[model samples]
Structure formats: C-alpha cells, structure tokens
Target: MTPTLQAFVLVSGALFSIGLLAALSRRHAIFILIGIELMLAAANLNFIAFWHFAPQPHQPTGVMFAIFSIAISAAEAAIGLAMVIAVYRHYHTTNVDQLDQLKG
Candidate 1:
C-alpha cells in the first residue's frame, strides 16, 4: 500500500519526539549529539515529504533543503564530536553533568 503525507508526518513527529527525549534525558555528550542528529533527520524527512507531495513537482526546493540540511548537520556533527573529544581529553569524562567548570 502507498503511504500518505499524514503517515510521513506522523513518522517524522515520532522521530522528533524520540530525539527530543534523548537530548533532554541523556547526560552523555555522544548520546546528546545523536539525539540532535535524529532531530535533524526528522526535519530532513519532513522537507522531502512535503516536497514530494507538493503540487509543483517540477520544483526541487524540498530536495535541495534536505541536501543542504544533511551537509550542515554533518559538519555540525563533526565539530560537536571534536569538541566532545577535546572535553574528554581535558576532563577525562563525557558526562555533561560532570562538567561544572570552564577552566582548563
């Protein structure tokens, strides 16, 4: 059976919800980053879904947005991971709650 826009939106919403929960509840830097990435993915899915369902199928705006988002998210993820690695190297921990001071 073919899926509808509502189905895609529902799935996207679910992914966003999970991502939010992970970002808010997790103390580990890596987990939080993962949550953020999940949220980005949901957004990308939304862009594509709307684009696919749009009346003007000739336009590539939605796909373009999704692609740009992916590229930006990848760059952000790399930077975030680099920051996490630096933090770990400095503090010897990746737990957000454990990080209280900003000093080296």
Candidate 2:
C-alpha cells in the first residue's frame, strides 16, 4: 500500500523523537553520535517523502538535497568519530559525563 504524507510525517517524527531521546539519554560518545545520525536520517526521510508527494516538473531537488545531506552527514560522522577517538585516547573514557574537563 502506498503511504501518505501524514504517515511519512508521523514516521519521521517518531524517528526524530527516538534520536533526540538517544542523544539526550546516552552517556557514551558513540551512542550520542548515532542519535545525531538518526535525526539526520529522519530529516532525509521527510525530504524524500515531500519530494515524492509534491509535484515537481522533472526536477530531482529532493533527491539532490538528500544526497547532499547524506554527504554532509558522512563527513560529520567521520569527524565525530575522529574526535571521539582522540578524546578516548586522551581521557581514556568514552562516557561524555566523565569528560568534564576540556583542557588536556
């Protein structure tokens, strides 16, 4: 069955909520990054859903935007992971709550 915009919105909202919850509740740096990624995916889902439902004259605007966003997200993931690794090496802990001091 074909899904409606409302359905897509609901799903996206749910995904965003879960992501927000994970980001806020998790103490590990990796989990926080995963939550951020989930939020991004929700945004991408919204973009695609809108593009599919809305009329556009032979334009790939939504797809392009989603692709661009994916690229940005990839870069973000890489940078985030690198930072996590660096922090782990320096502080020997991945728990964000434990990382109180910024100065090394």
Error of 2 at 97 (Å): 0.7
Would you list the C-alpha lDDT of every candidate in the order shown?
Answer: 0.97, 0.96
The C-alpha TM-scores of every prediction are 0.95, 0.94
Clashes of each: 0, 0
Error of 1 at 67 (Å): 0.5
Q: Compared with the true structure, what per-residue lDDT tens digits does model 2 show for residues 1-104? A: 88789999999999999999999999999999999999999999999999888875757888899999999999999999999999999999999999999688
Question: Residue by residue across 1-104, what tens digits does model 1's lDDT show?
Answer: 99999999999999999999999999999999999999999999999999999996478999999999999999999999999999999999999999999787
Count residue pairs with overlapping backbones in model 2.
Answer: 0
Q: Which candidate is the best by TM-score?
A: 1
The residue-level lDDT of candidate 1 at 104 comes to: 75
